[model samples]
Target: GAGVSQSPSNKVTEKGKDVELRCDPISGHTALYWYRQSLGQGLEFLIYFQGNSAPDKSGLPSDRFSAERTGGSVSTLTIQRTQQEDSAVYLCASSLGTSGGQETQYFGPGTRLLVL
Candidate 1:
């Protein structure tokens, strides 16, 4: 795809289960980000990866959430021991590496996760 694409447009999982969501950024985009939007909430930043530099994980809501970008292209977000509060639409975004934290990002359609 020419834009960022996320796998498993929808997911339903039992509580305490683990789930993995995948994202593929546009070719050559060096910066990637993960965000989630819960009901009635705006996008919440989760993680960011830029090139081979250390990923910025400051936005993660809990220790159960983690993400990684490999080969500067694909990214995976894992949620362990999922809770009902973890249900949300996970969104991925990517941008050119030129502008540091100010670069414009293109977003994916998002993976809707439902924890029951």
Candidate 2:
């Protein structure tokens, strides 16, 4: 892929139902990240995967929220038992793993999750 891509730009689900969002990262990029943006809020780091290294799961908000990056490329974010507060835009980005945050990240058009 030339750029990061996310599926179903807008999703509306009933409260308590689970949802699975997908992210496809750019080719050759080693670092993939998932973030959440609440209404008018900053991006909250959810999870990070850099190459073959053990995934950095420190940012996951709760056990209900989880993600996995397979083959060091694509990723999926699963929100189990979604709540009203869990509604937000889920964003994915990719960057060179070794560089610090100073490097510009390529971001996908985020998936908007709405829990009704």
Candidate 3:
């Protein structure tokens, strides 16, 4: 919990009601990513976990979204029944998931979901 840490940085519901953003990483990072930034557009790759494999949710954008990463750190992104374009700003990142290339991501301080 030194770099990637997010939780209720700001959240406002109303449309459908359903939110649970939360993330905690940076310790012995294995690889965790969930991004979404609307309003201005840029980063939107929500879902990815690498450790026990099987987690790249293919950038969830429907099905009301969903995410989970237990035992490998801590993560929980649920936005069921919510609408209003799912106002975004939810982001979380971690790295050190060595494989072949690319490995350097440490971000958090997002979770500004406002759907009113």
Candidate 4:
């Protein structure tokens, strides 16, 4: 079985530019999550998708951030106008179930975004 994976291990962009980050969750996993880790800050939940349910976007920092999961497998996080403060490691995780019980989340290596 494959684990969660992310693309473009590193990205460098000018402020105000747009960037798209991709993630592929393990096959058959029904729950997926996106998180961000800024310098000197802990990991923050960004968004989540479970099965065919509407995504939870409450964790998104602002209107500039958005994401979508296609076919309940691959997901993409899009930043409309990148900012210096948006520089961070974007991580993706997947779990077998959505309940907050015994399911364990597997994380990807993360995509590092650097907005200049």
lDDT of 4 at 79: 98
- Model 1, stretches more than 4 Å misplaced? none
Q: Global lDDT of each model? A: 0.94, 0.92, 0.88, 0.94
* lDDT of each residue in 74-101, candidate 2, tens digit only: 8999999999999999999998777868
After superposition, the stretches of candidate 3 with alpha carbons farther than 4 Å from their true spots are 1-14, 17-30, 34-48, 56-64, 67-78, 83-89, 99-105
Q: Candidate 1, TM-score vs. the true structure?
A: 0.96
Give RMSD to native, each candidate.
1.0, 1.2, 11.6, 1.0
| Candidate 1 per-residue lDDT over residues 19-42, each given as its tens digit | 999999989899999999999999
Tens digits of per-residue lDDT for model 4, 18-99: 9999999999898999999999999999999998999999999999999999998999999988999999999999998657
Candidate 2 to native Cα RMSD, angstroms = 1.2
Tell me how far the alpha carbon of residue 100 in candidate 4 is from the true structure, in angstroms, after superposition. Answer: 3.3
Candidate 4 stretches with Cα past 4 Å from truth are: none
Model 3 superposed RMSD (Cα):
11.6
Give the count of colliding residue pairs in each prediction.
Answer: 0, 0, 0, 0
Residue-wise C-alpha lDDT for candidate 3, range 4-100, written one tens digit per residue: 8899899999998888999998999888999999988899887899977889898898988999899988889999889998987989988878862
